[model samples]
Target chain A: MTATVHRLRKAAPSLDPMLALVAGDMNAVNAVILDRMQSQIPLIPELAGHLIAGGGKRMRPMLTLASARLIGYTGTRHHRLAAAVEFIHTATLLHDDVVDGSDLRRGRRTANIIWGNPASVLVGDFLFSRSFELMVEDGSLKVLKILSNASAVIAEGEVNQLTAARRVDLGEDRYLDIIGAKTAALFAAACRIAAVVAERPEAEETALDAYGRNLGIAFQLVDDAIDYVSDAGTMGKDAGDDFREGKMTLPVILAHARGTPEERQFWKDAVEGRRDSDADFAHAVELVQRSRAVDDTLARARHYGQRAIDAIAGFPDGAAKAAMVEAVEFAVARAY
Target chain B: MTATVHRLRKAAPSLDPMLALVAGDMNAVNAVILDRMQSQIPLIPELAGHLIAGGGKRMRPMLTLASARLIGYTGTRHHRLAAAVEFIHTATLLHDDVVDGSDLRRGRRTANIIWGNPASVLVGDFLFSRSFELMVEDGSLKVLKILSNASAVIAEGEVNQLTAARRVDLGEDRYLDIIGAKTAALFAAACRIAAVVAERPEAEETALDAYGRNLGIAFQLVDDAIDYVSDAGTMGKDAGDDFREGKMTLPVILAHARGTPEERQFWKDAVEGRRDSDADFAHAVELVQRSRAVDDTLARARHYGQRAIDAIAGFPDGAAKAAMVEAVEFAVARAY
Candidate 1:
């Protein structure tokens, strides 16, 4: 346990500095989130509160806040926008839990489990609508266009993932495209909006967008890797959930690609046939480890993480920029 | 069959005149809808097409088109906004079917039944995001605000209905609030967007909103009444679906209000206790008939229908206005 703690410490710098830097803004964002989530319909607040109150790290919203600060945005619009970003994220999580038939989130029972799929889906719709309301209130057409487009793209990605589920032939480029649309589009939108509100130049906007897009790809790649390497206690979900659910994440795709004919047959059985017993999971993990698929996935994540750092190279050196860079590293290093 | 056809013919004036007036714009809206519903993910279009092609009366989009024509506005933006309205309604229907666990819609299998709940939820989300994309493309903040707020209210109403499900104590006022949010909010927003895009006076906007809101309430009241009075062949869903699902629609609420001790007990058993069977549905239908709940519900519907006419009475009499008035009558008379 001590060694594990020490290794974790050496894994990467904490997000503490970034969190601290934007703590004041984050508090305001939280207030908006709490206030906007309220509804006269009791079940809405009750169901939404269960998920929001479970308190996952507000990583996406932090990116919005951090990017805004990095771009030297001085107005209060970013707070509302940050809250909007969190609402969008939370809304997707609710619907994703329903779509994934997930049992646990953040080590707690998912809202869908407690309230049923209907409530989760409806509350998710409510949160999504509320996010748009916030965006409308922000009163920026450019921002609205960016965020709304990102939302559409996110849905497309989810559908693409659905189509790709359980297919052994799922390619790496398609996997990246799925993550790019589902995860990075929002990250790009969230950061780009800071530039929009800051009234920054197009180049700055593009830079921040690239930074967010790459960071988001890295974040998801590392997340897929962590599923293979981490335990349920650390990952907040059972290991090999993707395998059981027949999800085609990066490591699974890579491992399948590099595996022997026998190993390939094993994946087809475990994933496509859904023969995911404990033994199957154990064997799958061993195969993935042997193929160095986890290492390859992390390497890809680091590649994107570095691009994220490069995307913001044009920005002047500042505490916010430093923190943002550390955040990219932190996202990648989580797999270690 | 002949007698039923005669009754349906006498029950309502057709929406054909209104549909005819806006046929060109409606065609354009359909084109946009077909165009926008497409995604690289084949499953999305495939699933959305199954539902969209099943062909419910495009009444909501017609409302937007007719409302725009009523105000003598000449713009193509209404076509897109109307499409957006239909998309919102369709998205809600997809989600609602999932929430209701419905098996049939429009005399066909439901999307959830065909594609599974996960696909339905995600595709519903895709449609919703697409709706927002349309709204943003229309590029009106007022329209965005109205539609987005309506979306939020719609979800809230769905949650309220969930909470009120199987509860015999739900009052009429709460019932009105629920339908107002779930059904009428979109109608109101749809009609109001016509005025918004036309840059009409505040009075015109308010008047259109009232017309749509009251019309929506009337429409729902008649729909609930039809569930008891009409057969599955006509209603495109099994009769007594509301009763079977323990939904607190007006007819059920009214029947409960007017029932004797024994009948009330029967409702409690069939609805709240989830003991509904074919016999229970038959008995419930009989009790509703005896209590005149269907008639009373239609009377309430007519009252709102009349108010919808009155709300638009200030407008000069014209073909557009006449068609709008006929729509209200058609909504109420559907219960006949």
Candidate 2:
């Protein structure tokens, strides 16, 4: 493992009991997950397998499994829910590539680029249906309700982002709402739903939901910040890629909000007018840094991360709780 | 009213009960639907409105309300579900216009032609999200489960249709499966879910579901046949529109399956490739008639219609039951 991987692992709590639970005593849950994730069409399986194997951190699915384990779930529904979460994430990624018109994702050609937009779209639908089919096997109405609402929120967030693209008038609250809808809602749903499926007490369910929501918010904010400041090679794309694509990320919006008339004019002409060249992109990056937008963005992410940790404070200091806390800290501290 | 309208009124039963149920006694449902369906953006709302108001007979939403009532539902959730069904159908129409590159729908310009593809696609997403938001208001896990599955199936069916387009090997079973997934699944869900939410007995629910499935199959078959035989004004838009677009409707597929070598070659060239003028279209229409393909197609539709009526056989004979039977008969008998 790389140093980053080593660091993340060291920080992770050793929840042996939870791990044992997920291992299904004979690794049956893992087998079920693997068997169910396969697509009927070889190409869909291949494309999805590539993404699943591409080191996604597996934060959402892990939460689902961990939440179920923490709540003392005995049946195999958690396994199905975990697999459902992963499928939902993968489906969103397929659609996201089309919406972003992206070529590379995680240092590889996007599925849209490799398999064509129609294939990506159709396969994405297949995954979505496959998810419902899996969840139905679990026969848990709570899981269905949570996941369905999450999908709708995610789609709405995408639409809102599309409408907000290239517009510099986006404020901090709007950014929060957009990202919350797009990213955090599903993350929260993933963990919250695991608890719901396990039939946990209402208080524990509420605490876990708050923790997941805050953690997800922090994760997205950090991602936005990294998009403006991370190394192109390490990040698998250019820094300020969002700005180049005319996305009004938090840093750019903040920087523009605080810019002088001349600076604002430059942005109006460049960002909104499709000025996606190296020079224009570099200028935008410089402006964001000069304005200290990166610092403010990081601070906001840290605030959310702290709140994430705070959310789990009501629980006993067990290994699962500690691991959840550490995950939030690592999310805020990590570099791309 | 015209003779056709008068006949339709006689055949359509008293839709007032279903309409009133969908609109609710308070009348807020219609206002909400009108408000949500109205577009503030330029040209999009106009085109969408034109199609939305195109005297569509509101068949899908009516099915939802009628099924819910048949199951003894007393809640307002059915109204919201009805609205959601309409939104989904409208969204599909928007996407279908782009995929078919259609200029007119129900004798009016399609949304794609009026608002461009990008706008139509994005707004289609909007309507999709709106549908989910509407469904979410009911907070019924059963309803969410049914709708989510239906949405996924619809997307899959669209993808399958896209793949099957421009191919001559598209057989009858594949065609039926495609239409079943794309169109009938939602209708089936609309009817069955009402029974589900009302907590009816499984047998009754299954019956309503079968009624919807058979009705949808019959509805699509007759609609496809009318593309060849009906007047442009009566059917809305010009006749032979599907042929001009190279769509392989039931009549064409039937004719091709039973044709001689010369007729088969003509089918392959005209339906699969080599775009032709008005003369070629005329010749193709003549061939379809000479082969008696339309008769076979209508017979198949009637078979499904009979099954639809048979599905509701156990229900105590009442106006609603009679109306459903008459509706099926009218749907199949219209073109003839």
Candidate 3:
């Protein structure tokens, strides 16, 4: 192993087993996701297939498989669970693009832009329903409960974020709460369910859930941080896109708090009003950088990344745990 | 009993027993719906509440309660189930308004009009998730399976509708399939679930499902028929509005098939193009009326209504069963 992997393995040995299982079956999980997303409606299936095949990191599904492996599951149910996770995530993305009026997603034209908001929203709902159907096949009420709750929390968080936009008072705590609901809740549920389906001990299940939640927080924090610094190609979105949209990400929240009076006033006006020009975006980015918001936000992400590693302290030594630790570190550590 | 209570009791003896359990308690269900629907965002909750209280017939929930009673259910779970059904229906309406870009609904401004599409879409997601959460609380994996599957089918049907828009060739078979998924599937599932929850005989469960399915189909057919004939207040919307939107209701479809070459081309350009003005709408309505499309469509609806009554043939003669039968007949009996 490379020095980075070696260090991660030494720090969190439990990740090794999970990584082995995930790497071994990544292709199979992808196949399952594709197969189940197909609809009897010819146009729907074709459109959904094209969107699903478009490159995505598939990070949420990885959590499901990894958690199951960590809990010593040998059944194929994890594969179904992984696919379900992907479907739910994809459904949310389709709806999100429509709601956000976004033309681009993951460095490509969004489904809503191609088909129309009506198609995307309805198809997104289709995926959500289909995901539940997949979970039902497992016959686990606990799994359904976890997922259903997570789905509700995710929706609530998105609504919260909508209200949070352009508000000067959005703080770190609310930010964490928003990200937890919007992003981490599903990740946590994805991992927790992996353990639950395997019938692991409650302690281990809780540990895996914590790990997932912390990892998700780290992922989103870094995402927000990168929104200020990275280009469209690297970040899979335009730079300062959130600023233009008046979204109150962690970096912007921090920057606003630490800015001078004039800077704060600029942010308030910029966020509340539409900022469509390059100069407007550049101004937001400059102010964020000047206030050290990016650095502070990166520090917060690293903190959560470390918390993720700490959450899995009790798992047995393995490659899965190690990779998970490495992945969390990589998420926030990279400049991009 | 008061006259209304006596009338209800006379019509549906089985429903009398169930109403004894649920009538006074429906407020709790409504409260649950309202509480769960509240968002941190002012616009979302404000608009959602207005629409939720917008004089809906609330047939889905009543069907849920009646079905559970028919199956001898004694548990409080039916209330939760009823609320979930209503939430799902409401969520769909919210999204549908946005999809149709409708300014008016039920003779009032639509949620999308008052709150904007973003809030409507996101809040719709909120209600969808809330419905799932309620289903989870029922602790029946079987119920979750039924509800989620129905939800997915509903969404798929919507996507199919979106793609089929403005297509003059959308036939009866395809229309039936779409409505089955979009409308009847949930109605069928709602009844089926009551049987499942009450642990009724398999045959009885099947019968209840058939009853709901036929009833729902009839209900939709009547709704479509009324679109061409009923006035705004009586039908709860303007007359012949479907023509303005280019929606091919059953009457329109029947008339189109029976129209002369000139009439066919007129409909093809006007309704399908969604470019119909008052004159065009008047002409189309007049043509449909003269072609006997309204009568023909009503005959089709009555056929399903009869089938709905037939599906309940096995049930013992009781007030509830009779009322249920009346409900089906009433669905298509008159415009109101």
Candidate 4:
């Protein structure tokens, strides 16, 4: 379902290869996720399951599993650690919904909308605490340190984003810093911990971290690009949602940077919540297209995508390596 | 400033002894707190400082230090751990304010009111994550497990309390369960971790756990009683806050159980948010007084307070022991 031409295969790049590589490990991770999320308070699981069982791709945990396979670590410790990573991700999503007052995610009602913000907040806290418990059970202070630091960075990035909200002047450097912390930090930690569990050396740990970090940036750039490009519908996101919310995504940054003075004024109005009508969004699309902002955004995604693939190039060639490469390809190719 | 008579000296019970015992260590813990709450993002430290620097009693961290002192472990490790405990407590308070939609706490505007719910929610997440980071830095998996489990239990209790909100039929057993998880779990964990860090035996850990747990319950029971007995204002809590919010505390539970049919209906209306007028609260207080509900609640507090003191009876008799006993007395004596 991807559009990028593979130089060697002439076929579309897809995540199927990575999914196949980690299917068994993924099952183990899923089981741990379902098992640990249950609580004596029924609302805890009910609210959590709505999102956990919701039909989003288990992208973060899959990275953990895939990274384990790439390193040829055949132990089962990543199963629990992968589940912990997913729990952190799920907790972040639940809290994000509350913070944004988001009613829908991935074509489903958010937990906050269904269960109310208080439940969402508390259950999110539950999952977060549970994630740490799982890490402690794994008995790796190193892993605990990594994940906990990622969590703090994610919170910091969220606060940064919150404070920077609706400001058209939030240039690319600050925007990238925001996404690096909020999105890439966990992906990096998720992959890095696999190395830690495998007893891999610092070099491998750092390489895997780079791989996940770069892929995460690419993934987020595409997601942000999708918000401005209505026809990018293969991904289940509803375009213009960010526009309506006046979110300052990279495309908005690029479009504002490259626009005429009048166009920059229009962009500022849109970001500041004044212009959100369909016609306004349509004009926004026209302006971004005229300035090639979406094109450059995807170009930036591909740049990071290439870095991700190269980060793992030193690993021995095998199905795992090929799938990992194709996964980055698939990530960057989605916006096409 | 406390009313309870000490058997040994015929003097009033007070926290001054305990406060004096931990004064030096508390400064070190405070230093750690001030150092760690900083962030590159200005708003994080800005919002967190407003509450952390705001005049909180630092009771949870003080418990950690006091427990360490009682065990005669002269290490300074509890300084950082105690700060971590205080962070966990502050995070909980921030989220609690958001959950309760409370505008004031400790007679000052809450973080949610001064900033907003979004800031409070994110900063709470930051502090929670930061607390785990602190625990991880301490490099004790045992401590991590205790604090992590306590954190999860606190979230579960919060969800339980939310679901049980505005329900007059919430009996004593369920109310105890709720408070046990919400309030006592952290207290137990805070005190228990001191033993873990001191390398004390399991028996000491369990004893400290019981001491803190029972004291937490007694502390809460008296706070609930104070809500009904508005003239009991030495605790700095604005009494009758729970009544207006339709909170079903122990005082309401006992009063409803002892009320006549008409009085029960009034309580039903009060707990369900129908009866919140000043005259209604006055009549409600009169009913609770005639039923002796507040008196019995304080009696229950004394029961737990005695249990708390007895739990640590095996520890050596020293200033720490006397201070700990008087602290319990000071807690349960507040309602009188």
lDDT of each: 0.87, 0.71, 0.79, 0.91
For candidate 1, the per-residue lDDT at A144 reads 89
For model 3 the local lDDT of residue A142 reads 86
For every model shown, the clashing-pair count is 0, 0, 21, 0
Candidate 3 regions with alpha-carbon error over 4 angstroms: A1-21, A230-232, B1-22, B38-45, B230-232
| Per-residue lDDT over B204-269 for candidate 2, one digit per residue giving the tens place of the 0 to 100 score | 888988988888988888888887774535457576787877887788888888899888888888
Fraction of reference contacts reproduced per prediction? 0.89, 0.17, 0.75, 0.86
Number of the top TM-score candidate:
4
Candidate 2 structure quality by residue, lDDT tens digits, A1-336: 222121223343433444443444224444654676564335656767767676565567777776665566666667777777777787778767766778888778888798666566556655665676677667676666677677767766776676677777878888898899888987888888877877878787777787788878888877778877747444466576677777777887788889999888777666586577888877877888899888788788878877777766765556566566666766777543
lDDT per residue (tens digit) for residues A1-336 in model 1: 121111112355767879998999999999999999999887887888888878677877888899988988888998998888888888899999999889988788999999999999999999999999999999998998998889889989988988888888889999999999999999999889999999999999999999999999999998888878745344466677777777788888889899999998888877686677878888888989999999999999988988898889878777998888888878888756
- For candidate 4 chain A, the 10 contiguous residues with the lowest summed lDDT are A1-10
**Residue range with the least summed lDDT across 10 consecutive positions in model 1 chain A:** A1-10
For model 2, the docking class works out as acceptable
Instruction: Report the candidate with higher TM-score, 2 versus 4.
Output: 4
Which runs of model 1 end up more than 4 angstroms from their true locations?
A: A1-11, A230-234, B1-12, B230-234, B273-275
Q: Name the weakest run of 10 consecutive residues (lDDT summed) in model 4 chain B.
A: B1-10
Top candidate by lDDT = 4
Work out candidate 3's RMSD over C-alphas.
Answer: 4.4
**Whole-model lDDT, candidate 2?**
0.71
TM-score quality measure for candidate 4 = 0.97
DockQ comparisons of all candidates to the true complex:
0.77, 0.26, 0.66, 0.87
> What are the per-residue Cα lDDT tens digits for candidate 4 across A168-255?
9999999999999999999999999999999999999999999999999999999999888878666677989999899999999999
Please say which candidate is ahead in TM-score: 1 or 2: 1
lDDT of 2 at A240: 65
Measured as a fraction from 0 to 1, the native contacts recovered by model 4 come to 0.86
